[model samples]
Target chain A: MAAVALKNQLNAHIASMFAAGFLDKQFQELQILQDDGSSPGFVSEVVGLFIDDAEKITGLIAGLLDQPVVDFDKVDALVHQLKGSSASVGAQRVKLSCEQFHSYYEAKNRDGCVMALALLRNEFYDSRSKFQTMFQLEQQIEACS
Target chain B: MDRRRIRVLLVEDEEIHRVVARAVLRAAGVEVEEVENGAEAVRRVRESGAGGGSGAYNLIFTDKQMPVMDGHEATRQIRAMGVATPIVAVSSDSLPPDVQAFITAGANDFTPKPLTKEKLGHILAKFGLA
Candidate 1:
């Protein structure tokens, strides 16, 4: 596709993500930084970091949950870190899921925590796919531009 | 005082936050030095001296959550050393209580994170560094 068309496609796709509540203004802030030459590939770099960090945290949560004596404090702290990471990258859905996960862990409700983790995982995977798609679109635009 | 570009120390564990904040600060013509946590922040302040010297920072920006030490403790420690350099707490966790805690711990100001050029400009202006 031509650069303009690809750019438009990217914008529309990003708009859809925002409309779906998968992203927020902070993501746009990142894009602005990228555009201003503050940091080339800023968005992709941050998104990549978020994905790597979230994956590790998710695995840690799963391991903690599987332990016979679950350490709710540790789980909560990990979830909090995940939430902060999500917020940093403007991963709204994942951040919201992490917030929901908080109440469950806070109450020391193992069942609730398990259920919330499933939801959190689903949201995170969905957000990750969306980000990946955006990255591809950006790459296409860059290639043609 | 000295005629030099404003210098700021950025304390944030998250790499992305550090990247964004450094970009914004550098764009504003401010010199930035970064550390991943508060203990390093304290050490940097101590080693460089906070008294408007040749290598001292004019300001400090720190996140609330970190591994070795939190912003509150770092701010308190820096203050304890009698370094009056302005410390601004930059965080996403900006509840009233959190802001109050930062102030009580000796932060000169508080700003929400995903630090923007405008927000940073306001901070610099507030501290007369702009």
Candidate 2:
């Protein structure tokens, strides 16, 4: 009964993510891939990787922005990578933020880039929190099972 | 198609992409080898091509944006060495211009990033490996 409740909660949370546009079809694809039995815990593994990579990229971006002479090329490259990473995991909001970041990056507008980075950071953290919640629910369900 | 198992060389700088792609390919029973960047990919292709078929891969999937060397240059170098293996560009950029650029760079095919089993299947069938 407890596991059943946890499972339902997890499903609801996931549905809310999609409904809110925090995730997209790519996340469903990841679930399908995990279900294939080719790799157990694949979703969790990917979420973990995404978080680590996002953190590192954002840190790099922040550092670059702090420099008196900003290297727009390097910043753009990092953001591009972050966008790719977010897309792979279906972090829709974060990916969009990265795309917006690119425009400012292209213009070499440091202020705009800073604002974009903040937006990206917010999306990344929100998505990361949701993922963590999902993981916890999964763990509880597994324990009940 | 030969009865031998399909082998693929995956050239990607990102670890998450590598993990995802490798899982998909392995699920389809395809053998996979990974390299981090285009330069390493070039070296791997060269070495395998020189190994007299023992280490040769049937297909190569390369990400277009990477450090050290990008996929376009890698594809160009591989083609220059006269390698006949099917080279597929796997990238997030899938627009017409992107596709044209990949083809211009000598890629045999273009598949967008976040590769799915179906997409990979089509690639295999298209290349006569399926």
Candidate 3:
């Protein structure tokens, strides 16, 4: 019963993520990939990788932004990578934030870029927290099973 | 693994993307040979071609953007070598123009990033591997 409840919670959280536009069909594709006999932790493994990549890219973006003269091209490249990775995992909000960041990056608008970076940072953490919660529920269910 | 298993050459710089793609392809019983960038991909293809069938690969999947040679350039190079294997461009940029650019270069097909088993299967089937 505990496992069943945990499973329900996981499912509900995932459904809410989609409903909130925090995730999309691409995420469902990840789930389907996991359903095959590939690896039980396929989704978590990939998501963990995304988090790691995002962290490094986030650091790069910060460093670039802090430079005396901002290099919009450099920042744009990092954000582009982040956007793609986020989209792959179906992190819709983060992907959208990245798109905004790209627009500011292209215009070479420092203030706008800064604002966009903050929004992207916030969305990244928010999405990471929700993903962590979902993963925790999954682990609990797996442990009980 | 079967000696006669179908094989694919995957070129991706991102570790996570590589891991996910390898898992999906391997799960479907296909052999995967992974390389980090387009340059390495072209080299591998060249090596295989020179060896006269030792490195026979059924298909190739490359990321559009990378540190070294991008997918389009790599595709053009491989095509120039007379390597007839199907080349598929996998990128996060799902925009029509971006995808069309890769096709124009030499990619036989284009699939958006976060490749799934179903999408991989679709690509394989399109090439008659399925």
Candidate 4:
């Protein structure tokens, strides 16, 4: 693809991500991740990590509510990692979950923490594969450009 | 154990999902006791998971979200109260992170929504209780 066409495609994906509430401010920060024109894998790696982080956060939340063991730090780390990765992915809703998860934990609000956990569930549940598909397309545009 | 008479709890809040669960699980040759809310499920299981009689239920399939008591809270409470029943959660709400939520809340495994026989069987097999 021509550089101009690739850039147009990239802009279009960013727009879709914004409309879907899957990409926002943090992704903007990531848009400039290339240092002296680094590999597009920078973004791909970050997006891959976001998926892994989502899986881990699931574990941490379970630990939080489990009996005979409540692993707060596990939950916290998962949320923190999710925040960083989603920010890089420009996943708006995931980043929002991370933010709220941290806010509740810091406040020592048990109910809030639980609520945030549920909210996080909804964010992922609500995100269709199309959202990720869009992200992948953007990755392609970056590479081709 | 008689395959046709094993007691099983169907924990779900959605009416349509509950009906579907009942039809599918029962067809598999297990007696299913359905509960629409998590709090009620915990209560039912507490009275049932004691294993005093031969008719006791050994398994459960619960939905993740609901009013009054979500699956996570119900699972946590049931485990804390000594119900040793293996729980298999089936919900649209199941994700990798949510699986951890279910386990932390005392569920044994997670199955994605639009439950399938293969997934259900797989969950039962995981605990060696199939």
Which candidate number would show the highest DockQ if scored against the true structure?
2
Q: Best by lDDT, which number?
A: 2
Q: Which ranking of candidates, highest lDDT first?
A: 2, 1, 3, 4
Give the better candidate number (3 or 4) by DockQ: 3
Q: Report the interface RMSD that candidate 4 achieves against the true structure, in angstroms.
A: 19.3
Residues A1-145 of candidate 4 have per-residue lDDT tens digits of 4757767776786677688787665455344533323435454555555566676666667667654545566666567555544544567797677777887777656677778888887786555364566566666766775
In angstroms, how far off is B2's CA in candidate 3? Answer: 11
- Model 2: what TM-score? 0.94
RMSD of each: 2.2, 2.0, 2.6, 14.8
Expressed as tens digits, the lDDT of each residue in B1-130 for candidate 3 is 2345788999999988888788888888898999998899999999886333324888899998887898889988888887778889999887899889988888889998878877988998898888
Rank ordering of all candidates by TM-score, starting from the highest: 2, 1, 3, 4
Question: What interface RMSD, in Å and to 1 decimal, does model 2 have?
Answer: 1.0
TM-score, model 4 to reference: 0.45
The residue-by-residue lDDT of candidate 2 on B9-92, one tens digit each, is 999999999988988898888999999999999899888753333247889999999889999999998888888788999988
Report residue A48 deviation for candidate 3 (angstroms).
Answer: 0.4
lDDT of model 3 at position A110: 84
Q: Where does candidate 4 chain B have its weakest 10-residue lDDT segment?
A: B47-56
- Against the true structure, candidate 3 has what lDDT? 0.86
How well is each residue in A48-108 modelled by candidate 2, as lDDT tens digits? 8889999999999999999999999999889988988988888999999998898898999
| Model 1 spans with C-alpha error above 4 angstroms | B1-4, B51-55
